[model samples]
Target: MKQSLLAARYFNTTAEEAMDGLIASATPRQYLISVQDGTSLRVRIWSEIGLEEAQMGELLDWLRGVQGDIRSIQSGSTNAHDHASVVEKWVAERHGIADLFLEQLDPTTSSKADMEPELSLGVLGGRTVMISTNTLMFSRLQEGVFGLSIAQRGSYLIEQLRRA
Candidate 1:
């Protein structure tokens, strides 16, 4: 099997800015959205992605209307391990979906290093973060399908968020 290299980029931003940047650049419907009891929003955003600043504000306002406390963006930890741990929990829990599709898959069978580092974006503590353990922003190593270098998608995402 061709092993993927670990790649990641860290940024200090809000979920709205990050999501806006991602949605504007991403393919249609590649992302998924889940709201937790109208208290928190969980988006399974695609790695490859933005909206305009004004539109973004409006969209966030709508979310806030439905999900209270959506604007009190708190700061998140910069520690990568903490982020990884959060991912681990998410996988293990699978939000109660594991029994349906991943019944045979054991979360313990995979180590953090062994898992395919997926692209993820979220507000850790308060700050927004974008990361992919197996994507390279810049590298001479093996290129991905469609000529993408390691974390090419994630690299594009961070840049877009910063610009937004």
Candidate 2:
């Protein structure tokens, strides 16, 4: 199995300091990096080739254990599209697909647009997952930030999952 580092982890340090830790951990393999302001914690973004299932597990473990400065903020996955679809499907199954679609179309319904007028977040793989700033699980991936870095909010949510 293959997996990517899809996460919104919270660090108790500054963005620069947290990035230094990430760089140290991902050494020898050159992964792209990006940084931005966060609501309570700093946000960083990066991309690299996927890792094997076991390798991904090991890496996340090290990050949560030895790398005590980092905290997993939300559930992450090797693929964003798949995770978002799963979240959507879970919602649809419970609420009915037609009701879900109607809720999305309802303008009075609160959304990310109502809160921040200048934020656009999306991920592209086999498909696109548009991230909103609202409080939904998937939307919370890009909450409380005007920039493009994807992150999540929830106390110690990352530590619980221990995988990304």
Candidate 3:
């Protein structure tokens, strides 16, 4: 298997800038979205483990496909549940999907913040990318600030990423 990734870096950028980078690099083949009550957004992006970013149009198309898949969600489907079978199916075919990372979020915590926006949940692969305003946070490694070297993560993290 390829190396696992650990992207817990912190970049001092605005939320919008963070999203821009995340969107540009994301190449989600399949994804699930879930909400609690009427609020809270969580999205789990499924893709190849070390997947490369698609070109602009390709990324846009890929996003459209994800949206299309999301629309197909059953009446009670969500990113966490209602898609257990589907999640299992995808993960089985793509072990690289285990490389889960967060983006466009306030890692200090998930609570809603002052003017800044946060992406409740984000799952991604490839090189680590993290954008944040807090300087006190971030655990760097040999790879870099956001680079967590999946090759070193424990089985628990990998299993948890797959399970989620």
Query: For residues 1-164, what per-residue lDDT tens digits would candidate 2 score against the true structure?
Result: 01111222222122233234434443222222221332121112222344445643433342233112111213343243333333332222121111110011122337533522221222222111233233222222222221112344332121112146
Q: What overall lDDT goes with each candidate model?
A: 0.27, 0.26, 0.31
Tally clashes: model 3: 5
Name the lDDT of candidate 2.
Answer: 0.26
Tens-place lDDT digits, model 1, residues 31-149: 12333455433233232323334533443453343222111111222233333333232222212111110001122435533433232323222222322223222111111111112
The C-alpha stretches of model 3 lying farther than 4 A from their native spots are 1-54, 74-82, 88-123, 127-164
Clashes per prediction? 15, 1, 5
The C-alpha TM-scores of every prediction are 0.19, 0.18, 0.24
What C-alpha RMSD separates each model from the true structure?
18.8, 19.0, 13.8
Candidate with more favorable, higher lDDT: 1 or 3 = 3
Error of 1 at 117 (Å): 23
What are the runs in model 2 whose C-alpha is more than 4 Å off?
Answer: 1-45, 67-164
